[model samples]
Target: MQQAPRPRFGIMTAPMQVGYHDVLRVWREADAIREIEHAWLFDHLMPIGGDPGGPAYEGWTMLSALAAQTQRLRVGLLVTSNRFRPPAMLAKIAATVDVVSGGRLDFGIGAGSRPSHPLARREYEAHGLPFHDAAHAVGSLAEACTVIRRLWTETEPFDFDGKYVQLTGAFCNPKPVQRPYPPILIGGRSASVLRVAAEHADVWNIPGGDLDDVVSRSALLDRYCAEIGRDPASITRSIHLPVSYDQPGVTRDAIAEAIDAGFQHLVLGLAAPYPAGVARWVTDEFIAPSTWN
Candidate 1:
Protein backbone atom coordinates (compact mmCIF):
# COMPACT_ATOMS: atom_id res chain seq x y z
CA MET A 1 0.00 0.00 0.00
CA GLN A 2 1.21 3.49 -0.79
CA GLN A 3 1.50 5.58 2.34
CA ALA A 4 0.08 9.08 2.43
CA PRO A 5 2.50 12.00 2.47
CA ARG A 6 2.53 13.68 5.87
CA PRO A 7 3.21 17.40 6.18
CA ARG A 8 4.40 19.35 9.20
CA PHE A 9 1.70 20.38 11.72
CA GLY A 10 1.23 23.57 13.73
CA ILE A 11 -1.22 25.39 16.06
CA MET A 12 -2.41 29.01 16.29
CA THR A 13 -4.16 30.50 19.33
CA ALA A 14 -7.41 32.44 19.45
CA PRO A 15 -6.04 35.97 19.58
CA MET A 16 -9.24 37.52 20.89
CA GLN A 17 -10.61 35.10 23.44
CA VAL A 18 -7.56 34.18 25.50
CA GLY A 19 -5.59 35.84 28.25
CA TYR A 20 -1.80 35.91 28.48
CA HIS A 21 -1.70 32.91 30.81
CA ASP A 22 -4.00 30.86 28.58
CA VAL A 23 -1.86 31.63 25.53
CA LEU A 24 1.28 30.53 27.36
CA ARG A 25 -0.43 27.32 28.46
CA VAL A 26 -1.28 26.55 24.86
CA TRP A 27 2.39 26.93 23.95
CA ARG A 28 3.38 24.69 26.84
CA GLU A 29 1.04 22.00 25.56
CA ALA A 30 2.41 22.34 22.04
CA ASP A 31 5.93 22.04 23.38
CA ALA A 32 5.03 18.72 24.96
CA ILE A 33 3.66 17.39 21.70
CA ARG A 34 6.50 16.30 19.48
CA GLU A 35 4.11 15.97 16.55
CA ILE A 36 3.38 19.68 16.57
CA GLU A 37 6.33 21.56 15.02
CA HIS A 38 5.17 25.18 15.09
CA ALA A 39 3.02 27.58 17.14
CA TRP A 40 1.65 30.93 15.91
CA LEU A 41 -0.13 34.04 17.20
CA PHE A 42 -2.34 36.46 15.33
CA ASP A 43 -0.74 39.91 15.23
CA HIS A 44 -3.56 42.29 15.99
CA LEU A 45 -4.39 44.97 18.52
CA MET A 46 -7.81 43.38 19.25
CA PRO A 47 -9.66 40.19 18.48
CA ILE A 48 -10.04 39.45 14.79
CA GLY A 49 -13.72 38.56 15.16
CA GLY A 50 -14.74 40.01 18.52
CA ASP A 51 -15.24 43.43 20.00
CA PRO A 52 -12.66 45.95 18.86
CA GLY A 53 -12.51 47.13 22.46
CA GLY A 54 -11.63 43.64 23.81
CA PRO A 55 -8.25 42.58 25.13
CA ALA A 56 -5.76 40.96 22.76
CA TYR A 57 -2.06 40.54 23.18
CA GLU A 58 0.31 42.35 20.86
CA GLY A 59 2.06 39.94 18.46
CA TRP A 60 5.70 40.88 19.07
CA THR A 61 5.35 41.14 22.83
CA MET A 62 3.67 37.72 22.90
CA LEU A 63 6.37 36.44 20.55
CA SER A 64 9.09 37.52 22.96
CA ALA A 65 7.19 36.17 25.96
CA LEU A 66 6.51 32.83 24.25
CA ALA A 67 10.16 32.58 23.26
CA ALA A 68 11.20 33.12 26.85
CA GLN A 69 8.77 30.46 28.12
CA THR A 70 9.01 27.61 25.63
CA GLN A 71 12.07 25.48 24.87
CA ARG A 72 11.07 24.06 21.50
CA LEU A 73 8.69 24.85 18.63
CA ARG A 74 8.97 27.62 16.00
CA VAL A 75 6.97 30.80 16.75
CA GLY A 76 5.48 33.56 14.52
CA LEU A 77 2.53 35.72 13.58
CA LEU A 78 -0.13 34.05 11.41
CA VAL A 79 1.29 37.14 9.90
CA THR A 80 2.20 40.56 11.12
CA SER A 81 0.40 43.12 9.02
CA ASN A 82 2.85 45.41 7.20
CA ARG A 83 0.49 48.29 7.93
CA PHE A 84 0.63 47.86 11.71
CA ARG A 85 4.36 48.26 12.30
CA PRO A 86 7.07 49.76 10.15
CA PRO A 87 9.38 47.24 8.51
CA ALA A 88 12.48 48.33 10.39
CA MET A 89 11.02 48.04 13.89
CA LEU A 90 9.43 44.69 13.06
CA ALA A 91 12.84 43.53 11.83
CA LYS A 92 14.51 44.67 15.03
CA ILE A 93 11.90 42.95 17.19
CA ALA A 94 12.15 39.70 15.22
CA ALA A 95 15.92 39.76 15.51
CA THR A 96 15.74 40.33 19.23
CA VAL A 97 13.30 37.43 19.68
CA ASP A 98 15.52 35.19 17.51
CA VAL A 99 18.48 36.09 19.64
CA VAL A 100 16.57 35.40 22.85
CA SER A 101 15.05 32.11 21.66
CA GLY A 102 18.28 30.77 20.16
CA GLY A 103 16.72 31.39 16.73
CA ARG A 104 13.16 30.03 16.55
CA LEU A 105 11.06 32.81 15.02
CA ASP A 106 9.24 32.51 11.70
CA PHE A 107 8.97 35.96 10.15
CA GLY A 108 5.41 35.82 8.77
CA ILE A 109 4.07 38.94 7.07
CA GLY A 110 1.01 40.07 5.11
CA ALA A 111 -0.50 43.06 3.35
CA GLY A 112 -3.30 43.83 5.79
CA SER A 113 -6.88 44.02 4.46
CA ARG A 114 -10.40 42.73 5.03
CA PRO A 115 -13.88 44.13 5.72
CA SER A 116 -14.30 41.88 8.77
CA HIS A 117 -10.63 42.10 9.68
CA PRO A 118 -11.39 45.51 11.09
CA LEU A 119 -9.11 44.97 14.05
CA ALA A 120 -6.00 45.50 11.96
CA ARG A 121 -7.62 48.57 10.44
CA ARG A 122 -8.55 49.95 13.83
CA GLU A 123 -5.01 49.37 15.10
CA TYR A 124 -3.56 51.24 12.17
CA GLU A 125 -5.97 54.17 12.30
CA ALA A 126 -5.59 54.45 16.06
CA HIS A 127 -1.86 54.65 15.58
CA GLY A 128 -2.44 57.37 12.99
CA LEU A 129 -1.63 55.15 9.97
CA PRO A 130 -4.19 55.66 7.27
CA PHE A 131 -5.64 52.33 6.24
CA HIS A 132 -4.35 52.04 2.70
CA ASP A 133 -6.36 50.43 -0.04
CA ALA A 134 -5.36 46.95 -1.23
CA ALA A 135 -3.03 48.14 -4.03
CA HIS A 136 -1.39 50.80 -1.92
CA ALA A 137 -1.17 48.42 1.04
CA VAL A 138 0.73 45.89 -1.03
CA GLY A 139 2.92 48.55 -2.60
CA SER A 140 4.14 49.73 0.78
CA LEU A 141 4.38 46.10 1.96
CA ALA A 142 6.59 45.16 -0.99
CA GLU A 143 8.98 47.91 -0.05
CA ALA A 144 8.74 46.92 3.62
CA CYS A 145 10.00 43.46 2.72
CA THR A 146 13.10 44.91 1.10
CA VAL A 147 13.58 47.15 4.08
CA ILE A 148 13.23 44.26 6.52
CA ARG A 149 15.58 41.94 4.62
CA ARG A 150 18.31 44.52 4.23
CA LEU A 151 18.12 45.58 7.85
CA TRP A 152 18.41 41.99 9.08
CA THR A 153 21.53 41.15 7.02
CA GLU A 154 23.15 44.53 6.50
CA THR A 155 25.81 45.43 9.06
CA GLU A 156 25.94 49.14 8.39
CA PRO A 157 23.05 51.56 8.57
CA PHE A 158 21.74 52.75 5.20
CA ASP A 159 19.11 55.08 3.87
CA PHE A 160 15.79 53.53 2.78
CA ASP A 161 13.83 56.04 0.77
CA GLY A 162 10.89 53.89 -0.21
CA LYS A 163 7.83 55.74 -1.52
CA TYR A 164 5.81 54.74 1.57
CA VAL A 165 8.49 54.06 4.16
CA GLN A 166 11.50 56.31 4.58
CA LEU A 167 14.34 55.93 7.03
CA THR A 168 17.89 57.25 7.48
CA GLY A 169 20.87 55.76 9.28
CA ALA A 170 18.93 52.60 10.12
CA PHE A 171 20.56 49.30 11.10
CA CYS A 172 19.59 46.24 13.20
CA ASN A 173 21.86 45.14 16.01
CA PRO A 174 22.21 41.54 17.31
CA LYS A 175 21.48 40.13 13.87
CA PRO A 176 19.05 37.24 13.68
CA VAL A 177 20.45 33.98 15.03
CA GLN A 178 19.05 32.13 12.07
CA ARG A 179 21.47 32.45 9.21
CA PRO A 180 20.06 34.67 6.46
CA TYR A 181 17.38 35.43 9.06
CA PRO A 182 14.49 33.29 10.25
CA PRO A 183 12.13 31.73 7.74
CA ILE A 184 10.02 34.46 6.07
CA LEU A 185 6.39 33.38 5.52
CA ILE A 186 4.35 35.84 3.46
CA GLY A 187 0.57 35.37 3.63
CA GLY A 188 -2.25 36.58 1.33
CA ARG A 189 -4.19 35.77 -1.85
CA SER A 190 -3.98 39.02 -3.82
CA ALA A 191 -1.96 39.31 -7.02
CA SER A 192 0.31 42.06 -5.76
CA VAL A 193 0.92 40.29 -2.45
CA LEU A 194 1.54 36.95 -4.16
CA ARG A 195 4.09 38.64 -6.39
CA VAL A 196 5.85 40.03 -3.35
CA ALA A 197 5.91 36.59 -1.74
CA ALA A 198 7.36 35.00 -4.88
CA GLU A 199 10.11 37.57 -5.17
CA HIS A 200 11.32 37.31 -1.57
CA ALA A 201 9.54 34.93 0.81
CA ASP A 202 10.98 31.61 1.91
CA VAL A 203 7.45 30.33 2.48
CA TRP A 204 4.04 31.45 1.22
CA ASN A 205 0.91 30.97 3.38
CA ILE A 206 -2.50 30.77 1.75
CA PRO A 207 -5.51 31.55 3.88
CA GLY A 208 -7.62 28.52 4.79
CA GLY A 209 -10.19 27.28 2.32
CA ASP A 210 -11.48 24.11 0.69
CA LEU A 211 -9.01 21.91 -1.24
CA ASP A 212 -9.85 23.32 -4.67
CA ASP A 213 -9.75 26.86 -3.36
CA VAL A 214 -6.28 26.57 -1.81
CA VAL A 215 -4.87 24.56 -4.70
CA SER A 216 -5.97 27.16 -7.21
CA ARG A 217 -4.24 29.88 -5.24
CA SER A 218 -1.11 27.78 -4.90
CA ALA A 219 -1.11 27.26 -8.68
CA LEU A 220 -1.33 31.00 -9.16
CA LEU A 221 1.58 31.42 -6.79
CA ASP A 222 3.55 28.89 -8.80
CA ARG A 223 2.82 30.91 -11.90
CA TYR A 224 4.00 34.04 -10.20
CA CYS A 225 7.17 32.29 -9.07
CA ALA A 226 7.88 31.02 -12.61
CA GLU A 227 7.37 34.40 -14.25
CA ILE A 228 10.20 35.70 -12.09
CA GLY A 229 12.53 32.82 -13.04
CA ARG A 230 12.26 31.27 -9.58
CA ASP A 231 11.19 27.69 -9.10
CA PRO A 232 7.82 27.32 -7.41
CA ALA A 233 9.39 24.62 -5.28
CA SER A 234 11.71 27.22 -3.81
CA ILE A 235 8.84 28.57 -1.76
CA THR A 236 7.34 26.33 0.90
CA ARG A 237 3.54 25.98 0.89
CA SER A 238 1.30 26.23 4.01
CA ILE A 239 -2.30 26.96 4.98
CA HIS A 240 -4.13 28.24 8.08
CA LEU A 241 -6.98 25.76 8.61
CA PRO A 242 -9.97 26.03 10.89
CA VAL A 243 -9.97 22.86 12.96
CA SER A 244 -13.10 21.64 14.72
CA TYR A 245 -12.36 18.69 16.94
CA ASP A 246 -16.08 18.05 17.31
CA GLN A 247 -16.01 16.95 13.71
CA PRO A 248 -12.85 14.86 13.49
CA GLY A 249 -13.65 13.99 9.89
CA VAL A 250 -13.60 17.63 8.85
CA THR A 251 -10.11 18.08 10.27
CA ARG A 252 -8.94 14.86 8.65
CA ASP A 253 -10.39 15.85 5.29
CA ALA A 254 -8.76 19.25 5.48
CA ILE A 255 -5.32 17.76 6.05
CA ALA A 256 -5.72 15.20 3.28
CA GLU A 257 -6.93 17.82 0.84
CA ALA A 258 -4.11 20.17 1.72
CA ILE A 259 -1.47 17.48 1.21
CA ASP A 260 -3.02 16.48 -2.10
CA ALA A 261 -2.84 20.12 -3.18
CA GLY A 262 0.94 20.43 -2.43
CA PHE A 263 0.71 22.29 0.85
CA GLN A 264 3.37 20.92 3.19
CA HIS A 265 2.37 22.57 6.43
CA LEU A 266 -0.89 22.92 8.42
CA VAL A 267 -1.63 25.28 11.29
CA LEU A 268 -4.73 24.42 13.29
CA GLY A 269 -6.77 27.53 14.08
CA LEU A 270 -8.18 26.77 17.51
CA ALA A 271 -10.94 28.72 19.21
CA ALA A 272 -9.98 31.20 21.89
CA PRO A 273 -9.00 30.41 25.53
CA TYR A 274 -7.33 27.18 24.37
CA PRO A 275 -9.70 24.25 24.22
CA ALA A 276 -7.16 22.07 25.96
CA GLY A 277 -8.92 18.73 25.77
CA VAL A 278 -9.97 19.09 22.15
CA ALA A 279 -6.49 20.27 21.17
CA ARG A 280 -4.69 17.42 22.91
CA TRP A 281 -7.12 14.94 21.41
CA VAL A 282 -6.65 16.33 17.92
CA THR A 283 -2.87 16.06 18.10
CA ASP A 284 -2.56 12.74 19.87
CA GLU A 285 -5.46 10.87 18.28
CA PHE A 286 -6.18 12.34 14.87
CA ILE A 287 -2.74 13.85 14.07
CA ALA A 288 -0.31 11.31 15.50
CA PRO A 289 -1.61 8.17 13.75
CA SER A 290 -1.58 9.88 10.36
CA THR A 291 1.96 8.61 9.77
CA TRP A 292 3.72 11.92 9.30
CA ASN A 293 6.69 9.61 9.70
Candidate 2:
Protein backbone atom coordinates (compact mmCIF):
# COMPACT_ATOMS: atom_id res chain seq x y z
CA MET A 1 0.00 0.00 0.00
CA GLN A 2 1.16 3.51 -0.71
CA GLN A 3 1.94 5.56 2.38
CA ALA A 4 -0.26 8.58 2.93
CA PRO A 5 1.12 12.04 2.40
CA ARG A 6 2.57 13.85 5.41
CA PRO A 7 0.63 16.88 6.67
CA ARG A 8 1.82 20.44 5.91
CA PHE A 9 0.33 23.61 7.38
CA GLY A 10 0.05 27.08 5.85
CA ILE A 11 -1.82 30.35 6.28
CA MET A 12 -3.95 32.44 3.86
CA THR A 13 -4.72 36.11 4.33
CA ALA A 14 -7.49 37.20 1.96
CA PRO A 15 -6.54 40.67 0.70
CA MET A 16 -10.10 42.02 0.78
CA GLN A 17 -11.10 44.64 3.33
CA VAL A 18 -7.59 44.72 4.77
CA GLY A 19 -4.58 47.03 4.62
CA TYR A 20 -1.33 45.90 2.96
CA HIS A 21 0.75 46.60 6.04
CA ASP A 22 -1.49 44.44 8.21
CA VAL A 23 -1.27 41.51 5.82
CA LEU A 24 2.48 42.01 5.53
CA ARG A 25 2.95 42.04 9.26
CA VAL A 26 1.11 38.75 9.72
CA TRP A 27 3.07 37.08 6.92
CA ARG A 28 6.37 38.39 8.25
CA GLU A 29 5.53 36.92 11.63
CA ALA A 30 4.52 33.60 10.07
CA ASP A 31 7.83 33.57 8.19
CA ALA A 32 9.77 33.30 11.44
CA ILE A 33 7.42 30.72 12.90
CA ARG A 34 8.63 27.22 12.07
CA GLU A 35 5.16 25.71 12.20
CA ILE A 36 4.02 27.81 9.27
CA GLU A 37 5.50 26.14 6.21
CA HIS A 38 3.72 28.16 3.51
CA ALA A 39 1.80 31.43 3.08
CA TRP A 40 -0.94 32.37 0.61
CA LEU A 41 -3.15 35.22 -0.61
CA PHE A 42 -6.38 35.02 -2.55
CA ASP A 43 -6.72 36.50 -6.06
CA HIS A 44 -9.46 39.08 -6.23
CA LEU A 45 -9.83 42.51 -7.79
CA MET A 46 -12.55 43.53 -5.35
CA PRO A 47 -13.97 42.73 -1.93
CA ILE A 48 -16.09 39.59 -1.59
CA GLY A 49 -17.16 40.37 1.95
CA GLY A 50 -17.42 43.12 4.55
CA ASP A 51 -17.79 46.56 2.96
CA PRO A 52 -18.23 45.69 -0.73
CA GLY A 53 -16.31 48.80 -1.77
CA GLY A 54 -13.41 48.17 0.59
CA PRO A 55 -9.75 47.95 -0.47
CA ALA A 56 -8.59 44.75 -2.10
CA TYR A 57 -5.02 44.28 -3.32
CA GLU A 58 -4.26 42.45 -6.52
CA GLY A 59 -2.79 39.05 -5.61
CA TRP A 60 0.21 38.46 -7.89
CA THR A 61 1.74 41.92 -7.46
CA MET A 62 1.38 41.72 -3.68
CA LEU A 63 2.75 38.18 -3.74
CA SER A 64 5.93 39.31 -5.49
CA ALA A 65 6.46 41.99 -2.87
CA LEU A 66 5.82 39.53 -0.04
CA ALA A 67 8.19 37.02 -1.63
CA ALA A 68 10.94 39.63 -1.60
CA GLN A 69 10.26 40.41 2.06
CA THR A 70 10.06 36.87 3.44
CA GLN A 71 12.77 34.20 3.35
CA ARG A 72 11.55 30.85 4.62
CA LEU A 73 7.92 30.01 3.97
CA ARG A 74 6.77 28.87 0.56
CA VAL A 75 4.45 31.48 -1.04
CA GLY A 76 1.59 31.62 -3.55
CA LEU A 77 -1.92 32.86 -4.24
CA LEU A 78 -4.44 30.24 -3.05
CA VAL A 79 -5.50 30.50 -6.63
CA THR A 80 -5.28 32.75 -9.66
CA SER A 81 -8.47 33.22 -11.66
CA ASN A 82 -7.82 31.78 -15.10
CA ARG A 83 -10.16 34.38 -16.57
CA PHE A 84 -8.15 37.28 -15.16
CA ARG A 85 -5.04 36.99 -17.39
CA PRO A 86 -3.88 35.35 -20.57
CA PRO A 87 -2.06 32.07 -19.98
CA ALA A 88 1.28 33.05 -21.50
CA MET A 89 1.33 36.32 -19.58
CA LEU A 90 0.44 34.47 -16.36
CA ALA A 91 3.27 32.05 -17.09
CA LYS A 92 5.75 34.91 -17.23
CA ILE A 93 4.38 36.53 -14.07
CA ALA A 94 4.57 33.26 -12.12
CA ALA A 95 8.10 32.60 -13.33
CA THR A 96 9.18 36.01 -12.07
CA VAL A 97 7.65 35.26 -8.66
CA ASP A 98 9.48 31.92 -8.45
CA VAL A 99 12.75 33.73 -9.15
CA VAL A 100 11.89 36.43 -6.62
CA SER A 101 11.18 33.87 -3.91
CA GLY A 102 14.18 31.69 -4.77
CA GLY A 103 11.84 29.00 -6.19
CA ARG A 104 9.36 28.91 -3.32
CA LEU A 105 6.33 29.55 -5.55
CA ASP A 106 3.48 27.06 -5.66
CA PHE A 107 1.53 28.16 -8.70
CA GLY A 108 -2.20 27.92 -7.99
CA ILE A 109 -4.83 28.47 -10.65
CA GLY A 110 -8.49 27.63 -11.16
CA ALA A 111 -11.44 28.10 -13.49
CA GLY A 112 -12.29 31.41 -11.89
CA SER A 113 -15.19 31.74 -9.43
CA ARG A 114 -18.66 30.27 -9.76
CA PRO A 115 -20.97 32.42 -11.86
CA SER A 116 -23.55 32.30 -9.13
CA HIS A 117 -21.34 34.23 -6.73
CA PRO A 118 -22.68 37.77 -7.12
CA LEU A 119 -19.71 39.40 -5.43
CA ALA A 120 -17.20 37.40 -7.45
CA ARG A 121 -19.18 38.07 -10.62
CA ARG A 122 -19.31 41.82 -10.05
CA GLU A 123 -15.52 42.08 -10.04
CA TYR A 124 -15.32 40.88 -13.63
CA GLU A 125 -17.66 43.63 -14.79
CA ALA A 126 -16.02 46.19 -12.52
CA HIS A 127 -12.58 45.43 -13.97
CA GLY A 128 -13.80 45.09 -17.58
CA LEU A 129 -13.13 41.34 -17.57
CA PRO A 130 -15.49 39.00 -19.33
CA PHE A 131 -17.13 36.31 -17.23
CA HIS A 132 -17.83 33.38 -19.47
CA ASP A 133 -20.15 30.41 -18.91
CA ALA A 134 -19.14 27.29 -16.96
CA ALA A 135 -18.24 25.32 -20.07
CA HIS A 136 -15.95 28.04 -21.34
CA ALA A 137 -14.35 28.53 -17.96
CA VAL A 138 -13.54 24.85 -17.52
CA GLY A 139 -12.39 24.35 -21.09
CA SER A 140 -10.22 27.41 -20.96
CA LEU A 141 -8.78 26.30 -17.62
CA ALA A 142 -7.77 22.93 -19.10
CA GLU A 143 -6.09 24.63 -22.02
CA ALA A 144 -4.53 27.28 -19.82
CA CYS A 145 -2.90 24.61 -17.67
CA THR A 146 -1.44 22.94 -20.74
CA VAL A 147 -0.19 26.21 -22.18
CA ILE A 148 1.30 27.50 -18.94
CA ARG A 149 3.15 24.28 -18.21
CA ARG A 150 4.65 24.14 -21.68
CA LEU A 151 5.70 27.77 -21.42
CA TRP A 152 7.58 26.94 -18.25
CA THR A 153 9.24 23.69 -19.36
CA GLU A 154 9.63 23.86 -23.11
CA THR A 155 13.04 25.08 -24.30
CA GLU A 156 12.16 26.36 -27.76
CA PRO A 157 9.49 28.90 -28.57
CA PHE A 158 6.24 27.27 -29.63
CA ASP A 159 2.78 27.94 -30.97
CA PHE A 160 -0.55 26.79 -29.49
CA ASP A 161 -3.96 26.82 -31.10
CA GLY A 162 -6.49 25.45 -28.67
CA LYS A 163 -10.18 26.25 -28.85
CA TYR A 164 -9.86 28.56 -25.87
CA VAL A 165 -6.31 29.83 -26.30
CA GLN A 166 -4.00 30.90 -29.15
CA LEU A 167 -0.36 31.81 -29.13
CA THR A 168 2.52 32.32 -31.58
CA GLY A 169 6.23 31.97 -30.83
CA ALA A 170 5.32 31.95 -27.14
CA PHE A 171 8.12 31.41 -24.66
CA CYS A 172 9.04 32.25 -21.09
CA ASN A 173 12.47 33.81 -20.81
CA PRO A 174 13.30 33.47 -17.11
CA LYS A 175 12.17 29.95 -16.27
CA PRO A 176 11.21 29.40 -12.70
CA VAL A 177 14.16 28.70 -10.36
CA GLN A 178 12.58 25.40 -9.48
CA ARG A 179 13.74 22.73 -11.91
CA PRO A 180 11.20 21.80 -14.57
CA TYR A 181 8.77 24.26 -12.95
CA PRO A 182 7.13 25.25 -9.73
CA PRO A 183 4.47 22.90 -8.36
CA ILE A 184 1.05 23.52 -9.89
CA LEU A 185 -1.79 23.71 -7.37
CA ILE A 186 -5.31 23.67 -8.82
CA GLY A 187 -8.16 24.71 -6.53
CA GLY A 188 -11.79 23.79 -7.12
CA ARG A 189 -14.47 21.28 -6.17
CA SER A 190 -16.19 20.63 -9.49
CA ALA A 191 -15.98 17.34 -11.36
CA SER A 192 -14.69 19.05 -14.49
CA VAL A 193 -12.08 20.91 -12.47
CA LEU A 194 -11.15 17.68 -10.65
CA ARG A 195 -10.50 16.04 -14.00
CA VAL A 196 -8.15 18.88 -14.84
CA ALA A 197 -6.53 18.58 -11.42
CA ALA A 198 -5.95 14.86 -11.94
CA GLU A 199 -4.03 15.61 -15.09
CA HIS A 200 -2.13 18.73 -14.00
CA ALA A 201 -2.25 19.62 -10.32
CA ASP A 202 0.53 18.61 -7.96
CA VAL A 203 -1.75 19.72 -5.14
CA TRP A 204 -5.57 20.00 -5.13
CA ASN A 205 -7.43 22.29 -2.75
CA ILE A 206 -11.05 22.94 -1.75
CA PRO A 207 -12.47 25.35 0.79
CA GLY A 208 -13.56 23.63 3.98
CA GLY A 209 -17.14 23.80 5.18
CA ASP A 210 -19.04 20.51 5.05
CA LEU A 211 -16.72 17.61 5.81
CA ASP A 212 -18.80 15.01 4.00
CA ASP A 213 -19.01 17.17 0.92
CA VAL A 214 -15.26 17.69 0.68
CA VAL A 215 -14.54 14.01 1.33
CA SER A 216 -16.92 13.11 -1.47
CA ARG A 217 -15.14 15.59 -3.73
CA SER A 218 -11.80 13.99 -2.88
CA ALA A 219 -13.17 10.58 -3.74
CA LEU A 220 -14.43 11.98 -7.02
CA LEU A 221 -10.97 13.35 -7.71
CA ASP A 222 -9.52 9.94 -6.91
CA ARG A 223 -11.83 8.39 -9.47
CA TYR A 224 -10.78 10.97 -12.01
CA CYS A 225 -7.10 10.28 -11.33
CA ALA A 226 -7.63 6.54 -11.66
CA GLU A 227 -9.34 7.02 -15.00
CA ILE A 228 -6.23 8.87 -16.21
CA GLY A 229 -3.88 6.10 -14.94
CA ARG A 230 -2.47 8.41 -12.30
CA ASP A 231 -2.08 7.43 -8.67
CA PRO A 232 -4.60 9.36 -6.61
CA ALA A 233 -2.13 9.38 -3.75
CA SER A 234 0.38 11.30 -5.85
CA ILE A 235 -1.63 14.50 -5.55
CA THR A 236 -1.47 16.28 -2.22
CA ARG A 237 -4.87 17.04 -0.67
CA SER A 238 -5.17 20.65 0.55
CA ILE A 239 -8.08 22.18 2.48
CA HIS A 240 -8.66 25.79 3.43
CA LEU A 241 -10.32 26.11 6.84
CA PRO A 242 -11.46 29.43 8.23
CA VAL A 243 -9.95 30.44 11.56
CA SER A 244 -11.95 32.03 14.37
CA TYR A 245 -10.03 33.83 17.08
CA ASP A 246 -12.70 33.18 19.65
CA GLN A 247 -13.39 29.65 18.46
CA PRO A 248 -10.00 28.02 18.13
CA GLY A 249 -11.35 24.71 19.30
CA VAL A 250 -13.87 24.63 16.48
CA THR A 251 -11.14 25.27 13.95
CA ARG A 252 -8.94 22.66 15.59
CA ASP A 253 -11.68 20.08 15.31
CA ALA A 254 -12.12 20.85 11.65
CA ILE A 255 -8.39 20.41 11.15
CA ALA A 256 -8.43 17.07 12.91
CA GLU A 257 -11.37 15.89 10.82
CA ALA A 258 -9.75 16.98 7.57
CA ILE A 259 -6.51 15.21 8.48
CA ASP A 260 -8.43 12.06 9.27
CA ALA A 261 -10.00 12.33 5.84
CA GLY A 262 -6.49 12.30 4.24
CA PHE A 263 -6.01 16.00 3.63
CA GLN A 264 -2.24 16.47 3.91
CA HIS A 265 -2.00 20.15 3.04
CA LEU A 266 -3.97 22.46 5.38
CA VAL A 267 -4.35 26.19 4.73
CA LEU A 268 -5.80 28.08 7.69
CA GLY A 269 -7.61 31.22 6.53
CA LEU A 270 -7.01 34.17 8.83
CA ALA A 271 -9.62 36.91 8.83
CA ALA A 272 -8.40 40.49 8.51
CA PRO A 273 -7.83 43.00 11.32
CA TYR A 274 -5.48 40.36 12.58
CA PRO A 275 -4.65 40.63 16.23
CA ALA A 276 -1.08 41.16 17.37
CA GLY A 277 0.90 37.90 17.40
CA VAL A 278 -1.89 36.20 15.44
CA ALA A 279 0.61 33.95 13.68
CA ARG A 280 2.02 32.72 16.96
CA TRP A 281 -1.47 32.44 18.35
CA VAL A 282 -2.42 30.16 15.44
CA THR A 283 0.60 28.00 16.08
CA ASP A 284 -0.06 27.70 19.77
CA GLU A 285 -3.85 27.40 19.60
CA PHE A 286 -4.38 25.31 16.51
CA ILE A 287 -1.40 23.73 14.70
CA ALA A 288 0.62 22.45 17.62
CA PRO A 289 -2.32 20.95 19.47
CA SER A 290 -3.91 19.37 16.42
CA THR A 291 -0.68 17.82 15.17
CA TRP A 292 0.34 16.62 18.61
CA ASN A 293 -3.03 14.96 19.03
Best-matching candidate per TM-score:
2
For every candidate, C-alpha RMSD to the true structure in Å? 2.2, 1.0
Kindly give the number of clashing pairs for every candidate.
Answer: 0, 0
lDDT of 2 by residue, 183-276 (tens): 9999999999999999999999999999999999999999999998999989999999999899888998899999999998999999989999
Which lDDT value does model 2 have at 247? 82
**How close to the true structure is residue 201 of candidate 2, measured as C-alpha lDDT?**
96
Residue pairs whose backbone atoms clash in candidate 1: none
**Residue 173 lDDT (model 2):** 88
lDDT of 2 at 92: 99
Q: Candidate 2: lDDT of 160?
A: 97
Those runs of model 1 whose alpha carbons end farther than 4 Å from true positions after fitting are 1-6, 115-120, 277-279
Model 2 scores a TM of 0.98
Give per-model TM-scores.
Answer: 0.93, 0.98
* Model 2 bad stretches (over 4 Å): 1-4
Model 1: weakest 10-residue lDDT segment is: 284-293
